[model samples]
Target: QGTRELVGKVAEALASLPPVTVYEPEYVPKPPVVDTSEPLDIQRLDDGHTWLIQGPWLQRLMANVNFDDYESRMWFDKTLRESGLYQQLEERGIEDGDTVSLDGYEFEYQY
Candidate 1:
């Protein structure tokens, strides 16, 4: 009786998982070369950090969710925003800033 009850509970838990489907979505990768050809500028603003060029560049507008919960989060935010990409990340996911292969395109992100 004990074993049967355990098996039933396990079955119920497993059944809660989602069903798999074959509908795969298309994923466009980022450009092989950013074509930036120029170094980005870094700035320490009063609020958010800015890393970009005068004309074109990648920009990350970050917002700290919980300032007290984690110190690493703040550190990472500061570190990455000061990295090379700045606003030129290959794998960026800032809502509209979806990653797209920059195969020979000369366009900046505009909302």
Candidate 2:
């Protein structure tokens, strides 16, 4: 009898509670614009070298003789020389045989 009375009280209390309100978000659509007039330029630098300069940097491609060496040495050297460390050293008056230390790595400029 006590358990039934308690259950009845709980039901009455639940029935007296106010209803909850819910909110739903609206969706907005966005479309991208693309230009199709200009075509990609594929240039042949030489018999074995070809370069494709696209609109996006990731889309750019290069086919060269000895690509492995080119990627390892030429690209690595170019990117390294263009880095902030190299620029900072240059601004600080770097000279031949000057050693530069950055982020625990050290490099000596010979020319």
Candidate 3:
């Protein structure tokens, strides 16, 4: 025998749904981007934006695990430059989302 279901009686018919249903998007709007140069190390990201980023202690624990470098050093360097170390003091600390401003200069970075 075939797998088709037997038809129900007219009394068993289902009710129709409402033609319109209200919907609200769950998305929260993101802040607009104001461009600044910055560096992002998970360490630094953890430092400045603790709420927005992860903790360094956890990152340090994870860093011990080594991975193969399939990428060139230049790639890493480019990322570092964007981190905004150029504006930071030699002794200053930086976090991934932290913006640094120095004498007439500014940049951003992650520790």
Summarize candidate 1's per-residue lDDT along 27-55 as a digit string, tens digits: 73432222334565433223322223342
Residue pairs that clash (backbone atoms under 3 angstroms), model 2: none
Once model 1 is optimally superposed onto the true structure by TM-score, how far is the C-alpha of residue 36 displaced, in angstroms? Answer: 3.1
Q: Which of the two candidates, 1 or 2, achieves a greater lDDT against the reference?
A: 2
Worst 10 residues of 1 by lDDT: 98-107
Residue 49 displacement (Å), model 2? 40
- Candidate 1 residue-wise lDDT at 23: 81
Give the per-residue lDDT digits (tens) of candidate 2, residues 36-103: 23443333234322222233321221221123554443553453354333454455456666554322
Model 2: CA > 4 A from native: 1-73
Tens-digit per-residue lDDT, 1-111, candidate 3: 332342443324443434577799877443223233333232233345322223333233223322343233233334334544334423444446655432222345444
**Whose TM-score is higher: candidate 1's or candidate 2's?**
2
TM-score of each: 0.24, 0.28, 0.20
What is residue 105's positional error in candidate 2, in angstroms? 3.1
Number of the candidate with higher TM-score, 2 or 3: 2
